[model samples]
Target: MSIQYVGLKEIKGSLIILEGVTDVAFEEIVEITLEHGEKRVGRVIQITGDVAIVQIFEGTVGLSGSNTKTLFTGHPLEMPLSKEVLGRTFDGKGRPIDGLGEILAEKKIDINGSPLNPVTRKYPRNFIQTGISAIDGLTTLIRGQKLPVFSGNGLPHDQLAVQIVQQAKIAEGKGIENFAVVFAAMGVKNDVADYFRRSFEESGVIQKVAMFLNLANDPVAERIVTPRCALTTAEYLAFEHNMHVLVILTDMTSYCEALREISSSKGEIPSRKGFPGYTYSDLASLYERAGMLKDREGSITQIPILTMPNDDITHPIPDLTGYITEGQVVLSRELHQKGVYPPIIVLPSLSRLMKDGIGKGYTREDHPSVANQLFAAYAHVQEVKALASVIGEDELSDIDKKYMTFGHAFEKEFVSQGRNENRDIDGTLDLGWSLLGILPREELDRIAPELLDEYYKPYKKKGSDA
Candidate 1:
């Protein structure tokens, strides 16, 4: 029989200290029954000597003194797993809230999954097309890579996330039929969650998506389990079911905040910005779960989104995240103000594994050169604009004026696309060449002379419009 103890040596916030406890394992689930017969769920977070510190998932609101009964289940928290989980919606704790009823689990697995051995991990090489020119043509998202989207508050990162879910696909002709998405949102508003559901349903992709949502008003403690539960489902689908799964965790800043709150309640020593010292390791445990096995047919890729506080990239949340993920796609407030749809800064944005995913066989033969040339030309555009600002535009040389025209066309044509528009790789590359046509031939140093001869079209100077 499982042991039940009369607890409550102390109650602090959502945590309770129980004395004289035996055989209580760390992270073991505990059932707390109050004097009035109201029950709450908690987990053993820490154990020292004979005392255990339990964190209540439902919070300790009504409990008083040692009268409450604490039952130690002697097992960690687990979630039911099955292919039927897709198209279903669940709350933070993995309980179905979609009104579709309980899942007939194929098997149960611990939410804290085992890390894949490095020796058995295959390098991520294939590209996943997002259908956005800024991404597919520039910073390509590689299968099994962890790339994050860095944004500021009130930016359209949420919309971008939805678009990616609707448009992301494996390269054409790969003939891989099994693909899915595990989307987990932490501390989002009810309206935001509803938007995702409605969008997925309307787009007809909901059947292939498994959603885990923790609202802004849900118990903060539940936030800790949200991503873990979502990732566990992804691991099940990818490694066992042989499916390519994409896991999207939005607003990870909230997850970090929850960890800090729990740490403070436990009176633990704080690290940077009052976050726990183990924040990096805690995030690693979640992100490292994505990749392909040496001999497996499936893979898991992650796109973790976080809004930098006050637009500060140096904030601990984004600073730490940048260190862990492969690279970042940074959203720009300046570009948004200028009416860019995706508002990608492009300059600061990059994909570290992009080299492996693009080139001869993966994307297109001309992808590398096109991307490099666009980057070089855009970078020069910035310098030319700076010079034009100091010395009036009328004082600039003819070549600088041509660069000015190229800059305008690049933003209006290359970066800006209709919100609903989904461009294929060929179309995006074609548009890149069109924009490069506006610049003089001599300025195209990044492109091979052979490619320039084949693709470059000189833009006729003004007054030739007639």
Candidate 2:
């Protein structure tokens, strides 16, 4: 029989502290029953010297010191796992909110999963085509890498996330059949959550997606567990079922804020910008969960999206995330205001693991050279634009004029594709070659002579300044 402790030492925010408690484990589930028979669930976050600090999943609102009963469940919070989880919708705590009835568990696994053995990790390779030219042709998402998207307020990060969910796929040659997505949203508004649901449903990919949503009005404490629960299900699908899993975590800034609020409630010393000092390790615990295992047929890829406060990249959220994740796809407010669809700032965005995933058999033989030449020429365009602003366009050299024309064509034809338009690797590379062709062949310094000979097209129209 479990012992129920009567009365509480104190209640601070969503945390309930109990003194002289015995045999309580960290992360253990606690049931707090009030005088009026209303019950709230909590998890033990910390335990020291018979004192346990429990974070209530439902915020503590109606509890009193003398009448409350706290029963330790003696086990950590666990999530029910099964193949049935796909195509389902659940709240942040992993409880089904779809009204489709309870899941028949294959087995219950603890949500706080141990990290995979480093020796067992396989190096991530193989491209996962997202069908966005800004991504596939530039910042290519490797199958098992953790690449995040850094965006600002009111940027179309949510739409980009939906687009990825709808279009991401493994390269055609891999032939592995089972692929799944685990999407977790923390503290997002109801309309935003509804948009994701409707997008997945309308695209007919809802059958392959498992959604975990913690709304803006839900208990703040539940935000902390949202990603862990989502990743746990992802691990199950990837390792146990031998399925490739793509986990998309949106608005991680809210999760960090929740961490800060809980830390403040606990009276912990603050770090930079009033956030907890352990923020880096906390984020690492989440981002590092994506990878491929040796001798395993499946992999886990992550695209964690966080809105940069005031468009500041130096903010602790995006800063710490950049340190942990492989690379970042940065969205641009400038391009957004200019009416670009994805609004990806190509120059500032990159994928570190892209090298291992692209070229030859992965995408196309000419992909690396085309990407390199495009980057070089676009960078030149920026320099030319700055000079033109200073000395006026008419005074610039003929080569500078050509670069200016290339820049306009690049943004209009290459970066700004229709929202529903999905371009294959061949089409993206072809468009890139066409844009680069506007420049003289000698200006394509990044391309090797062999590749330039094969794909380069010179301007052919009579009296064409380009």
lDDT of each: 0.90, 0.92
Q: Give the C-alpha lDDT of model 1.
A: 0.90
Please write out the lDDT profile of model 2 over residues 1-466, one tens digit for every residue.
6999999999999999999999888899999999999999999999999999999999999999899999999898899999999999999999999999999999998998886789999999998888899899989999899999999999999999998888888777543358889999999999999999999999998999999999999999999999999999999999899899999999999999999999999999999899999999999999999999998888999999999999999999999999999989999999999998889989989999999989998899999999988888899899999999999999999999999999988887788888778888888998898888889888888888999888888653334666
After superposition, candidate 2 runs with Cα above 4 Å error: 173-176, 459-466
Each candidate structure's TM-score, on Cα atoms with residue i matched to residue i, is: 0.96, 0.97
Q: Give per-residue CA lDDT, model 1, range 1-466, as digits (tens).
A: 7878885899998899999999989888899999999999988999999999998988888997768999999898898999999999999989999999999999888898986679999999989988899988988999999999999999999999999998888885642468889999999999999999999999998998999999999888899999999999999999889899999999899999999999999998999899999999999989899899988888999999999989998988888888989999999999899999799988999999999999888988788999999999999889999999999899999988988888887887789888778998989988888788887778778888988888777654334672
Q: Model 1 segments beyond 4 Å from truth?
A: 174-176, 459-466
**Clash-forming residue pairs, model 2:** none
CA lDDT, candidate 1, residue 8: 84
